[model samples]
Target: MMLRQPCSWRMIIRTVTVIGLAIVTACASAPTRFYTLGTDAQPRITSSTASPSFRIEVRPVKVPTAVARSQLVVQINAAQVQVLEDDRWASSLPDEIRDALIARVNQQAGAPGAGTVAHGEDVPVYQIAVDVQRFESWPGSHVLIDVVWTVRTSADVETLTCHSAVREPVSDGYQALVGGHRRAIGVVAAQIAKVVRASAASATDSPLRFTGAAGKAAKGISCPHAADGAQAAADSAIAPLEE
Candidate 1:
């Protein structure tokens, strides 16, 4: 004769039910925040005039020997990257911006005809070198991109030197930086294209042969430019590449 158990089957069933309910409640109450980014945020404008026919090569922006070697040079701080205090981050901006610029240029100037170099070729007629100086979010809620750039021949010879600065307001939040970056990149692409076109036109009309003046001047000059603070846009939307 065994003694009867105090707990009934119904009690055990109820206990299990309560435990399951608690687990479900906790999951439902938990926060599920999500982050997203856009492909193109800032506005883009193409020059009304025809884009330069010349194929220009763009190199990654680098810190010049003069500035890097100088003790007076100010370095980018880590806090600036994480918080995006300004739109200036070392190397990151150039890498990302360069990619975006390439996309925009390709879009603006449709695919090449026969006899053109393959896409993403290293060899190009004109070469562009950029120095970032003041890339940051400004007091007016605008992202300012200041770049000192020079154009040269394919052999890294100098042609012309010019400076350009663009200030675009940040309309979207963290999710839109990718798009925002693309928009900013479009501006840079257009500006560089214009400069290249002008230089090419000048060379054509000049009494003195081009003899690669573009490459020489660009090589000799070293200028400091701007970069932006770092902020990751996790959900960036990209448009499909056109055929």
Candidate 2:
């Protein structure tokens, strides 16, 4: 016959309890992954032509401090939940936005505008600088991009500024994150290009109108001949769109 010790039974129970807790904790933690999009490979352009009616230049985007700080998981708060993938941080964030904007601008510059052929000559009679104001991650795996762009006439010294934003959603998982980021960048790039193009049209339109009104005013003042210089100057003012 044998007698069971109370202390021995209690020790066995405690060991089993610790093992169960370890298993539960492991199951509770969500997996982490890392990912990257747009490799060291050179960027590609789908087209080589654009209009020549106006010139445009694009500047690199500047990121804010808050944005940089937010990229790390250790910094995320209750309101923010960063998605990690493939042993790497998520690529859908703004870490890659500036590059996207640069690519689009280059593509635009390489292509001819409405009035000229893209021959690698910088015809853009204007320069534009883009300042990124709000680029961040959104709820439900989405990203938001906002920027304020200032355009200056390279020929006349006129200036105008505009602002715009874009919100895009992501798909599930790491692979999806890369693809979603590409698509989102494309959308933002298109929006930025559109704004720049609009500004170009406006700048040309303003001077063109001034030229016309000046020509008419000269006729009324019996000084129509004096307007020839103005018209010629305006015509020459049109610069090649920079690629």
Candidate 3:
């Protein structure tokens, strides 16, 4: 005969408590929202007279360390920065920028864009590369982008290096900020297209040339406006992320 005691109430309470705590933790965690660079947002350019443009390939985009993470980074003040864990890019920021640039360039130039060139690719085409010097959004204010870009032909005829700044007004939200960033990037793409077209047609007397190795990856700088003023709180804290 064995004596059996009742179930241990303490053990039952401990298990119940653990399960309840887990449920509470799950409920408390914020949801993550993903975004893209709007690669397909622009209206496709259609023209019977569109010039034959050089084949274009974009190298991996280079972005500043501050914004190289998966999270969305915003400069709220001179000293403070916000990294929004809940809001992030669908792909790496650099990758997204490269894709967006290619789409925009293709639309304008009627030239198909190629993916990142792997080693030994050496495709006989024009390669456009961009290094993001600064990409920053001041919610309720503006989006600013500064990039150093180069265009070079696989034939090694011409190369162009230029630093361009683009600014767009935002309407008080991260969504608006992203839209503004897209617009700014589109502007840069257009500029690149113009140059590539000129180079391809052999229309210019002087071949475009720049110092340094073309398609060379480079490090990026801090937020363009981080030194301007007041820092906003983390985007997760300030913006309501949709489930």
Which prediction has the highest TM-score against the true structure?
Answer: 3
- Measured against the true structure, the TM-scores of the candidates, in listed sequence, are 0.48, 0.47, 0.69
For this target, which candidate reaches the highest lDDT against the unseen true structure?
3
Error of 3 at 52 (Å): 4.6
Model 1: per-residue lDDT, tens digit, 73-173? 22234233333333333334445555555554433333233246554565346666778676553232446566776666554333556566766666545
Candidate 2 structure lDDT: 0.47
Which candidate do you rate higher for TM-score, 1 or 3? Answer: 3
Model 1 / residue 63 / CA error / Å: 7.9
Candidate 1: lDDT of 189?
60
lDDT of 1 at 227: 32
Preferred candidate (TM-score higher): 1 or 2: 1
lDDT of each: 0.46, 0.47, 0.67
Tens-place lDDT per residue, model 3, 1-243, is 999988899989999999999999998787888888865444344221343434678899999999998888887886778999888999999988998887877655557434433445533477887999998978888889989888776766545676678777889777887888877877777667655555555533444343334422122211223212111111212344332
Off by over 4 Å in 2: 1-56, 69-95, 108-122, 138-140, 198-243
- The lDDT-based order of candidates, best leading, equals 3, 2, 1
After the best TM-score superposition of candidate 2, give how far the Cα of residue 120 lies from its true spot, in angstroms.
11
